[model samples]
Target: MRRFRARHNASARPGRSALTSEVGWFVVIGVASTVGQALLYWVMRHWSPPVLANLASLLVVTVLNTEANRRLTFRGSPVRAVQAHLAAGGLFVLAYVITSGAVLLFRHYRPTASPAAETLVLAPAFALVTVVRFIVLRLVVFRRRNR
Candidate 1:
């Protein structure tokens, strides 16, 4: 079994290893971003509209995500970090818009719903945005060849 494991490890492709590492890094960054966003959302809940709270959360998470992705995920050059971060931020905003629109559409269809019900409908919308962001970040912002 030990020999089999050793052979399996040795036979793994270089790109596969890097991809695995990238995924690990993504999870780490995602956790940190989630925590940051949650905290920001909690703090702003009473003071702002839900849409504004969401935007503030997005902004906070994006900054944390950019720094984490640059230093840990891609190990990108410092020179390119700012450009990559800006591009990622644009993508983040696009995702946010899409999610927000989806939530608004749902709310329009169910105008009498409770806030909890609206939040349930919005969860999948934000999830869609997250998946898109992950793909864009991996394929565009932090591609191995580009870095």
Candidate 2:
């Protein structure tokens, strides 16, 4: 019984380590993706409307983000490439709605808020979506399959 318990714990250690590593990679990739999207949104907003810019920037970054998560953060996933990306699309939609809604709501209230202020509104929205995104990616998109 003691040997069995030790063996089980030893095996479990790698699982825990893998989860930690996955989360770390997720954070790194997510931060990079968020910054890139914010910058893109800033640049696009100069030429396009806020909602259009937000939509375009998110569309661009989401592809990269999904690919990065699939390749780096969730490297151990047995899911196929196309399937992973397709699943991530749902997350992208969720993020877009949250972030764009926040920006629009801010604009609605302030009427003449600066771009920087609008960008600041995204901070909390991103934080909220990121938490939800991580949970979905971990549980649904990147879940390890028992072989």
Candidate 3:
């Protein structure tokens, strides 16, 4: 564990690693962003298919989410933020897959899932992606020494 910390600088921020604090901040931002996405998905679910509505919500939120994590959670440069976004493209697709798959599965099984149900299903999916995002951002996107 000590060697791991030494190599990764895992505890750079006093007691806990900067990554740990950043993940706490990321959860804060993620909840807010998920709320926004849910509201948008609920609104757009009327006009679009549930999966498509989710994609639309993600489209609107991803940039904002990335930027917020970049500035607030990661404390990274704008240039590096852009690089993070580029790296995050795959993860975004992964998130979309998780979310859209959940919606699609509910609809397929229920065949008449409500908007509320769609939104409800998203809760778990978002939770899953949030962890993935944190790990990826910590190891790949904003490792402190990467600067």
Candidate 4:
């Protein structure tokens, strides 16, 4: 048993370990993005269209997240990093669309609910989308190009 365990530990590649570490870094980036979005929302509360706030927040978060994910998370080759960043940005846009559609559907179904109430429910839905985004980034976009 001890020999098996030692062998298993020794067989783990540094590349695989880095991928795991990247997920941890991505979580931190997600939290930061959430905070940035909240701050943008608070600042833009007076705007007629609140979605503008979300867009602005998404822009800010995307740049920050891309930089952090490139440097700290995946640590892919320069070519791969650039490609992954672009792909991930596109995915984020798709996530936004999905999240917005879901929120609108919720509002339509629950017409009696206040905007705040609907937003509260939609927050977690967006969070779920974010998780999907991370998985795509990790598995598809930022996946290391095996040399």
Judged by TM-score, which candidate is best? Answer: 2
- Sorted on lDDT, best first, the list reads 2, 3, 1, 4
User: What value of lDDT does candidate 3 attain over all alpha carbons?
Assistant: 0.82
Give Cα-based local distance difference scores for all models. Answer: 0.69, 0.86, 0.82, 0.66
Q: Which scores greater on lDDT, model 2 or model 4?
A: 2
Lowest summed-lDDT stretch of 10 residues in model 3? 10-19
Per-model TM values vs. the true structure: 0.72, 0.92, 0.83, 0.74
* Candidate 3 ranges with C-alpha deviation above 4 Å: 1-17, 76-79
Question: lDDT tens digits, residues 47-96, model 3?
Answer: 89887899889877777888888888878434476697888788889999
lDDT of 4: 0.66
Q: List, in order, the clash count of every candidate structure.
A: 0, 0, 1, 0
Model 4, range 1-147, lDDT digits (tens) per residue? 999988888777665677678778878877776666555544653453445655665667667777777777666545465676688778769756765576567757886765455456546655676688788877777665667
Q: Write the per-residue lDDT of candidate 2 for residues 5-60, one digit (tens) a residue.
A: 99999999998999898899989988888788888888888888888989898889
Model 4 ranges off by over 4 Å = 1-5, 13-16, 106-119
